[model samples]
Target: MNVYFHTFGCKANQYDTEVVRQAFADRGAVVVDDPARADLAVVNSCTVTHTSEAKLRTFVRRLARGGQGLETVVMGCAAALDDGTIVALPSVRAVVGGADPGAVLRAAGLPAEASLPFPLSATRSGGQGVRSRGWLKIQDGCDEHCTFCATTIARGANRSRPVAEIVAEARLLAAHHAELVLTGVHIGTYGRDRTSHDTRRTTLGELLEALVRAVPAVRFRLSSIEATEVDDPIARLLIEAPRHLAAHLHAPLQSGSDRVLHRMGRHWYTAATYRKRIEWLAERLPILGLGADLITGFPAETEADHRATVELVRALPFTYLHVFPFSVRPDAPAARLRDQLPPAPIRDRAAELRELGEAKATAYRAARRGARADGVVSGRQGGKVEVLTEDYLSVYLPTAGWDLRPRFEVTVD
Candidate 1:
């Protein structure tokens, strides 16, 4: 079988797709790059917003009508929460509804022997080898019930992987890739579920410590974590072990307005508390790659609230921002909330926030023009190889001598 795999949504989803791809390859299936030549297409879904589902529907339909009669297997978040909508799509052969490679293989008509859970081995793309940083999923699902999010609805409550298993996987991934990104729905809340069952509770900090010792040659990066969850040990590792851990953090701040945050069921920390933690990290690192996700025009959000968010962004030393306009998902509680903002204001607010984010990113990049940092060779772009710096900036360098090492010392230009 010639299979073409495409993924949507977060890094967790990407990791899932890669695992599925490897499983297909193990069963002697040819994974192709183009949909036209493939007999089957595996599309991983995301249920974050209405736009995401719409795109999936459109893509699935197009694949069906693309003259090759390509059949797609829809999996992931949308497949889980979809109310007969995804399976009803034309040319959708099967829907697995989760990131289970065994189910996906069965749906693809593979042999029953392919039902075992594939281990976290080194991933190779088209038999080329591991590319750039490897994504190591430490856990799945979320414990937090944010009103605006449907991730928990799709993925269920937080379920962490065993600590020993994660260390074994990290050691395996480190053999090929120099950096490993710890990914999950909520990675910061890594081991809270195991506290009751075991006397010695392991947190994300302890896991990181284990990974650092187990794979000292490979640097690890956190995919996305909450601001308040950056514990003392994690912070210390970022400050002290620069070579082992990247000095970058992507903490999601859904809304800067405390009232909006409360309405969104994000009661873990107030805006003031979030700011305090981020400011401390910023002050400690000379060039920290600080990023946050902001939602614009939430239900009942006022002009004053938007201004407060803008002010908060201005106060922080952010290298980048992922500004998302609030989109109503029917599965989420915020959909039924009173006083939802209109499309016009939501778009306007998102644009304003994005502009500010770009300015900050440009400034951060400019500041690092002459600074030398550790970087991994990402890929080729426009005849030059793009190197991703430790602080999460891209520096394009000549292709010569690129195959010498897994990482390079890059001077940002």
Candidate 2:
């Protein structure tokens, strides 16, 4: 069968899609890039917000009418929402819910055997190697039941992978890509579950030490982690071994007002705590690529609340922001809560934060006017291929092929 995999959502979802695609390929299914040339089109989706869900529905609808007579299937978190509207759609052939890696094959009534491993050990594109960063989803699921979140319900509780297994996978991925991004829904909480079950368990800090040692050549970037998780051990990596660990830390600050944060079910850190932690990180890693996620309008979010949030943004040394207009997902406590802001003001507030983000990003990029940043070329553009810096800047060069070697340093100006 000719299959085209359509993936939507976060890096974790992207990693999951690659795993699923490889599984299908091992079973003699020809993976095609174009939907029009495929017999099956599987959408590995995300439904973090109502708009995201709408985008998926529209995308699925378009695929069904693509003139290829393709069978459509939904996988990952969107399907896990278990929304009747998604499954009842006449266009959908199958729906696979939750984080079961092999949920698609089971939904398709196909055999999922262990012998047929992913054809290539390295990350492959169109049956050949491509410039890409390897993603290691070392953990999944969330334990926090934030009032505005539906992800925890979809993904279940935290279950971390063993350190040895992670190292093994990183070694294999290092053969193809020079850099690997360690990702998870909640990576900071890495060995919490295992440590509870067994005393001799390793934390995220210990795992990082092992990974850097195991694969000396490969640089690792961390996905989003809670502000509270940025302990002394993690901060020490910037000063000790700058080459192994990237100088970037994506910590989320959902709200600046402690009241708003509490109402949102955020427990890890207060506004002051978040500020202190990032300040410490910045002091250690001066050019540290700092980023945060912000929600503009939430239930009962007054003008004072919004002002406090904006003021906090101004105070922080953030290089980029993932500003989300407060989106209320069904079954979330925030959705049921009173005083939901209208779409207009929410959009206006989001726009303000976004402008601030753009300015910060431009400033951050400008600061690296003549700095030398190193990493393997991770992607190819029209004429210039992209080489991601140690601090997570995507630098483009005028000339390069798809398969650029590791240690391809570029002067970012």
Which digits, one per residue and each the tens of the lDDT, describe model 1 over residues 1-413? Answer: 99999888999999999888888898899998778999999999999888889999999998888728788999999999979999999999999888888889889998646446547444564464437788899999998899999999899999998888888888778767888899999999999888765577799999999999999998898999898999998999999998888999999998889999999899899999999999998889887998999999999999999999999998999999999999999999999999999899999999999999999999998888899999986667566787778788988877775674769798988
lDDT: worst 10-residue window of model 2: 114-123
Alpha-carbon shift of residue 208 in model 2 (angstroms): 0.5
* Backbone clash numbers for all candidates listed: 0, 0
In model 2, the runs with Cα more than 4 Å from the true position are 113-129, 196-198, 400-403
Question: Each candidate's TM vs. the true structure?
Answer: 0.97, 0.94
On residues 1-413, what C-alpha lDDT tens digit does candidate 2 reach at each position? Answer: 88888878888887888777777776788988788999888898887887889899889888888836788889888798866888876568888885454668766566865343433233555463454577888889989999998888888899898787788888888877777888889999998888654468778888898999899888888888888897667777766787888888889998889989999999888999999988877776767888898988888888888888888888888889999998889867799988899988888889989998899889988988788877567766578877788877887776545345656767887
Residue pairs in steric clash, candidate 2?
Answer: none
Error of 1 at 144 (Å): 1.0
Scored by lDDT, the top model is 1
> Backbone clash tally for model 2?
0
Q: Which stretches of candidate 1 lie over 4 Å from their true place?
A: 113-115, 125-130, 196-198
Measured by C-alpha RMSD in angstroms, how accurate is candidate 2? Answer: 2.2
Q: TM-score for model 1?
A: 0.97
